[model samples]
Target chain A: MSTAVWNGAGRRIHIQEVGPRDGLQMEKAFVPTAQKIAMVNALSAAGLAKVEVTAFVSPTAIPALADAESVLRGIERRPGTVMTCLVPNVKGAQRAMGAGADELNLVMSVSETHNLCNLRMLRSQSFAGLQEVIAVAQQGQAAVNVSLSCSFGCPMEGDVPEQVVLDWSQRFIALGVQGITLCDTTGMAHPAQVHALVRAFKARWPQTPLTLHFHDTRAMALANVLAAIDAGADRFDASVGGLGGCPYAPGASGNACTEELVHALQLMGYDTGVDLAALTQVAAGLPAQIGHDIPSAIVKAGPVHQLHPAPASLEEIRSRAHERLQATANGL
Target chain B: MSTAVWNGAGRRIHIQEVGPRDGLQMEKAFVPTAQKIAMVNALSAAGLAKVEVTAFVSPTAIPALADAESVLRGIERRPGTVMTCLVPNVKGAQRAMGAGADELNLVMSVSETHNLCNLRMLRSQSFAGLQEVIAVAQQGQAAVNVSLSCSFGCPMEGDVPEQVVLDWSQRFIALGVQGITLCDTTGMAHPAQVHALVRAFKARWPQTPLTLHFHDTRAMALANVLAAIDAGADRFDASVGGLGGCPYAPGASGNACTEELVHALQLMGYDTGVDLAALTQVAAGLPAQIGHDIPSAIVKAGPVHQLHPAPASLEEIRSRAHERLQATANGL
Candidate 1:
């Protein structure tokens, strides 16, 4: 049984924690700035190389991230931890830069319908805004990453063509963007689509860094991630507890749960440098915080090899037997 | 934006629902035979091509399956549904035959350690038992299928070699086993492993039918399925609502959720002849039935393309906004 270790691309898989930004944004309750800060601090302590701290969109647009600055200001700065904030436009970019964000992520939906529905802007306008955001971030000396939302498939437009994503990606990279994250906003990406898109993107921009943000709404996120990884994508965006849904893209679930993703990568002998047990513990705390049970498989079932204590006594065994009986009785 | 219709072997992907046998045996609860019948009936209503109805195991060994005969007799058979049962030995095979099971499935753990721990018998003893079971089933004119458990990996002895699975498969086929299921007992198989194993298994056993039974313990179940499909293995075993865990393996989750698997296959343009929305409705009833939430991704979040009703009233929009605020306030 020889184990193969993946040490490609000068680094192992980079899991960018998106709980604070992508996760909290879709929830119904307002996470206090301090709690958001604490979540970020906890995620950083959990050995996440990059944390998407918050999005710097207007408060009216997304009230969940209204206190982005305070959250960024409150978290303890760990060396080598890259803190990022999402910027919808140049104005958001300026706000994130002023808040001392290490990285600025400018997002523009690849599909015209999604672009209009999500950002309330035309595709051309969003691209223009992205160009402006990239210029401003560069001027501020902050690393700029561009996310092509609905790059795989769109809820409104249905199937998004690869050439569209590729054309937009080249445009973004030409504007001095540092990285590209192909966002499966509505979870419409299948494995083949992910592989083809990532392979094409990588070939066109070999030097540019690529990340994949996948949702588990269709249970294809991990498969898509594998396809992306096989296509040379090293970085990915995931939520801690599979929190977050697309408000615009109806019925879409949360991003790929970070703990489960890490567990899969680690078991595959990919060096994620994430403590699976610790991440599982942190994920356990999320349901209470979110006021709802999370969609994460690892959080509810625990890790792949996690062992429950053997039935200590005959009574315990009998009780387990009884419970099993009830489960079977109920026809499950 | 082209969709590939999966017609590798036939028009539809054959789904063999294994919850009744593989799933129920792992639970501690002794589900009543009548309830097991109801669950099988439900699965049939959900359009499954086949269902593994029960396991005829010893009362002393797997107490949960003590009433296997009663369970097998109780199911309300549906048209075109093939009811199968697991038979561990010649005695079990005889019991299954007497119970009027449509098919008799012989399970042999591929790894010697697993074979011992699971069956308390050596590899040769298990093979001998399989031969006896096959002979008995053949004499009864019942179809015999062999499931090679721990074919991908084992708990006691990690990473069962590919050759071991191939050798066991060859032996089982030679013993007149008509069908084979390669099971990832411990969820330790990767896509590459699945691809290699399925390709090799098919190359050697071109005439023998192959089915893939996978567990999502490490979140690689679906990926492995896709790899196997790409490698030309069409038939798969899935549980409704992703119900079931290994009785012997600690911390193992259920089989690949049927709804999620069907959704993936359909989205990839593979005709599964399954209505995902209808399955989702059936899956929603399982949590209450099982007394715990199943680790199915699609059940909680719905499919990726399922659209939610947008807030129609200003008050509703305000309520959504307020909920988001509360989520943020709660520090989620």
Candidate 2:
């Protein structure tokens, strides 16, 4: 049947795997530096376009990723995969560049309340810090990107004004940022919101690439991704095996899963260019690495086309069915 | 902000709570008959337009639901609620009618492989059995609805042809079935497929009502629901607390959760006419009832608009920010 879903017109969506950084940072126990490096190396080899290696924030603040420099130094970076790292301030930016991060991603929240709570800095202070970081990155000849956390909504501040987000994007765009990633920090984004915001953001900055970071705390990440795709936004930040948990919501799921996201995109005629089979092997190995089960649906359910055979009782049931028919005929 | 999602023009979606029947059937432990009845009562009272109370399948087949007769007899049917129960054969139809079922739901799998395995009857035999059940229901003046299982795809047979589903729907419509529920038996239903099938179904049979039942095995149930909604299908079958599990996909999640579905639809401004607050409480008490935690996103993450206050550090953060700014100014 010629339908919309099966029409595999050669459309492509870019994926940035952030599990090593975003997912690993949320773990209570520190992942070994070697394991972290291996995970990042496996992810890069899996055909992912970008890998957020680790954050250069204060090691004391997030000791789980304290070995960011060592891990960055160890990983084998593939040619097409751009190795990115999060830098919260100019110092982090300097360290990230020294560690050889191809793209320096700076983090700030759109909501003043969230910025204050998350970074202990005023919104303007974080923005100004980003300017300094961007300047440092420019000096080092490193590409700079800005990650606008809680661009959707703040866990504490409720609904963020769209104008607040647009204004910050405009300001960041003026600072020569190469890419802007709007994050749903607590899975607060709805499809319509994603659709409207992505459309609005793309309309404002056609040249600068846009990315969406979604949490599956509310199980709407894929739905939100679809909405973003329909709005013509291509890039997304996903974690392999759906690793990570929300600090705000206890036991809340983390990002839109990388393999799951890729699986859906590939099925729907949009090419993600990531090897789902190899990517799943990476996800399959994550539980042993992290010592916990991941919440990725594809991992649990298998791919949509994976067939499960009929239960083995079919042989017995055939005879039983014949007996039942005979008995029914006799009873009638 | 007159955006697409904000413009809610009062489109209504009808939810059929199948937790008491479909969800519980998969449970290993037997929930008390009183508990089953109370659960059904609570669901019907929560403004769900339809509640599938219980199945009249043979007790020998499913001992967990052996008290189906007691449950069906004990539940209080509220006005504006259609109490439906599964009637597998003419005997089930008679029993369900005797217990005062408003709608007798006859089930058969669209896939021959599934029908034979699940029902121990060939596809033609299942169709003949449905004819007998429909005839019995007609004599009792009870409404008949057909549940076409594996209409999306079967685990045993991969990629059930869309034409197969369409032909079955045509036959069921010809048999005067008032409503037909297409079930994603193994979570094979994707959004685009759901959209195409829903659009095609509605176009062919405008008068016959259609309902969509989906499992969240691959976590696309809600996304598929949104796609179905966009394609003009309004009815959905959901289980409370995301109860139930697929026999096919071990450890896979169950149906689209009732409260989570209601939460998203309500946030999107679609009127479900079901009280989300009351529904969530019902879902909250389900882990105790079923002896396990459900994977319902709303149960875990709360509603989209439920605000998580900023950590109790507004005063401290403001002072800390002031000190950081003062230190920066002194350096400046």
Candidate 3:
């Protein structure tokens, strides 16, 4: 496989669907609780490794996900698919565990400025709060995954030192978080930067389940993903239909489209363990479901395996060309 | 330097701007001839290695480029830029050379179905006709480049064997063509296939200047480019503002956006020789000129280096947080 050429793993890539939470949280119109449940169920049934179900943050903070409890209660859990929920504080963490979330996804920005703007707290305070949340999760049945936003580059800080990310990750790992997701919150990640950071991260914590979350704000998401893979990172966080945009970067695009990544990886001979056809069918309906057009290339242009019929007039053009050649040959 | 991880060249990558020819050819509205000339001039000035100025096809066949001669005459010939024009036949080749074109980009499809549908001729006829065109170009000051469409995979016929593309390329090289372009005309290419084909082509014809032309129809163009580079292919064909689409595949996007590729490459530590800022300035104006928004990511969301300002309420939020911390410390 060409992936071998880049020094990436040939093993099956793990895909975690984050559309239900990361994606829908950015939607202006509230995706009804029923639709959110249905979306999560569909994604889980499609055999994703994990599906971030919803955020357990306060309704006043993220009104879009105000129905977090209703959605958690409504979903039918599928075996082998972990249902995770975003937890902003110990309160949200307890709420998520009470509602039976399989994993608690704790997020804090690696950039102090971004942490303040995004979480309304300093990085120190956010870390302290997440420590409490992790402590709470340790008392429960759910696993904990810490998502470090602005792990690549901060919109405000420009570049977050690699050591900063490592230190925060190390701190979280000390608390026994099961996973760490490095997020390009506003899509400032480039391929080289991703490869370097991922390599450094892996070298330090090889056994930790690391997920590389990318946004296609500048159209470098998939390329970054490829670079991350080459650096020995396999897990990815993608949203359906390329849902979710950055509130900070006005014109930036959303998370890397789930189907786009799966389609490309499958073609590159990487077993993504994804049913692309099933995923695309669900992705194709997202435009109407979200009341907007999507940025998913696979949904817009069918998979490469899906053949487009020869131009409708192929035979007609062939016959016409034959007649013209005949006339020219006859010297008419 | 992470491009080092991919075993690709650290040398400056060549950028060929094809928006004027391959891109404008698909537009429904007739972009005014003057605008076309200005766009070409701007692209040439932006340090592109080659600019596909226009096509010399029959006006009846491509009315959008009816003013090809005028555009060729009007564009300021930048000293370092090669002004290439698409030549479909012996007549077009003659016209392009006569109009001061620096290079003639001759084209045919490796896939017989695509050849028949697109050129209304069989692969044999295309090869024979291109041979004649090559003979004509040999008599002129212009260099000849053969662009093999569907070299990756045909939308109608599916996979075109890598051997077929190489065989055609070998034939063109035998005809003394200065360049050979492997075109993924409908964007069916994936990373593995591109890497394999490019490796084969480079190994077989080490000296020939091979350009990889990819459409973003399926959004794998950049990834394919990265793979090609890893396989020792350097030259790429990209359109500004992603200004073209496949007629056969509905909803398919255009050629890989030039600025997007340049931005990604620049960030990956490879020099593309083109000025991204200058190129993006011209690309930003394309939407107004074309009467539609484009898919160029850098143009839409400014380049990664173009930092967005921090949100306006940071200090206020910081002050509030500090005040709350003081209140809490005081046991209020």
Candidate 4:
């Protein structure tokens, strides 16, 4: 993760498909554990570098992901793919580690109001609990990623200070975690904010890998991605079919769509390792499984370069145009 | 426009709403002329500097916009707003001028195959007709903007050569037109292509104003906007509710949503001269007007910072969390 180890020019972009975890958790109707496993296996087979298969929050808290263990056990594990899970507490951390999670993604918000509302825990209590979880994760030899919710702005508190984020990031670094994800939990991150914050973070923590998780709620996620890239942040967490929105976060919508991100990056000549065509087919089947139409433009309309065939009168028009051009060429 | 004349830092962004014409043209259900005019006037009232009211194509060619003259005559033209109409031929130009259009947007395709499929004429024929139309527009004291279709790429012919676009742009410049629109007729534009093209065009002709018209066919319109801005293009053509698409262009979807563009620009601290809230309401009414759901994310998700009220149990969570924090702070 050091700048010396970092590839020159920030060309490598890693996509951690969070659809099975973050996306399915947004659905009111619980997706069957078997189907979730199938999707994880499909995503793994499709060359995704990482997949957050499920979250290990209390079932009483998020019933949609109640069968997280079952899904984790059912999926076929691939050789090169890292399987990750979100764990909110010591209990969840233990359970996720027992499920053989390659990485444990921990969470809290920089906004105290958001942290309390989202997890019903004081900021200090959440950090204390996370300390115990991190110890357990270390004992288990599992990598940990601390995801900071509302890192840019909060619904109740307006804007979260950059110092608070940088301070907490330092705390996570002290805890010997793998990396950090600055989550735009409610899609409040803007391009300028993203650029300045990401640049400062990279300059401050050049050795820590940064992942940007964006929601397309305000239609700035993709733009923010570009800004992040311009500012030297490359890793992103995208959900397939643009799945994942917070029901509690009113007017909230899904993540930066996986296919859209991939298509855009690929068009810009950035290699994502994930095949867009294969990812698109997987996205196309998501609506049926989730009982709602996805908010994906690429799924609705094929790739930007996918062409429509010419009309039936193409021959007649071409003949007429050729005749005119030929007649003009011959000076008729 | 010259860089010296542009606002400092290129902070000014122009949005030309093309919903009244391009949007309704794709709907199978014919909208009343009165309703069309009402929408146009409402858009102008919403502070949109320009609105493309309707297209004056032959009724047999495109019946959806057959009542173009009625719509043009019915609208209450605001002094600050430039009311525009699409004109494909000399006859269309005459009808548009007679109907009091402030600007006639002449159209042809840079790709010969696209021209053959769309206009059923040779490229030379279309240009010849456009020359006559331009003369008529000049006589009527109406400004003209020539929209070159498939300026990025074409479905029928694949990639349209950049030389062709630049060469055609030069021709339009020689024809005494006021401005030029590089249309992404099939959403075949990416951020890199957009940035490079807009930069090339601006460097070539710093005097003529350039407008980018993009479809969110692959969910890259806003990203393309960012690129065009980075490359020095300011004006763009957007559709309210993301309502327009080409029926002939397979996989084509709506233009960049007006509320989306305005919302993104406003968030990025750029002035778009359009009220996003007022525009969102107008866009909300478009699904009913078009007999289909609109493709706008802002219209569905609201503005980026429109915070939702906290849950009813927030008091419970606050008390419980504070109690836990106090107990832990006391080391009890």
After best superposition, candidate 2 residue B17: deviation in angstroms?
0.7
Model 4: CA > 4 A from native? A1-10, A248-252, A322-332, B1-10, B248-252, B330-332
Model 4 residue pairs with clashes:
none
**Candidate 3 lDDT over residue span B169-193, tens digit each:** 8888988989999999989998888
Cα lDDT tens digits for candidate 4, A55-157:
9988987899999899888888888789999998889989998988999999998888898888888777788899999999999999999999999888777
Clash count in backbone of candidate 1: 23
Q: How close is candidate 2 at the interface, in terms of C-alpha RMSD after superposing the true interface residues? A: 3.6
The alpha-carbon lDDT assigned to residue A30 of candidate 1 equals 91
Taking all chains together, the TM-score of candidate 3 against the true structure is: 0.96
Report the first chain's TM-score for all candidates.
Answer: 0.89, 0.93, 0.95, 0.92
Candidate 2, residue B51: Cα displacement in angstroms equals: 0.7
Ranking the candidates on TM-score from highest down gives: 3, 2, 4, 1
In order of DockQ, best first, we have 3, 2, 4, 1
> Could you give candidate 3's per-residue lDDT for residues A193-305 as a string of tens digits?
88889989999999999999999998888888988888889899999889999876666578999999998888877877778988988888887777888888888789888
**Each prediction's whole-model lDDT (CA):** 0.77, 0.86, 0.87, 0.84
**What DockQ was computed for model 1?**
0.17
Best by lDDT: 3
Best by TM-score: 3
lDDT of 1 by residue, B162-223 (tens): 88888888887777777999998767676667877888888888778899999886677887
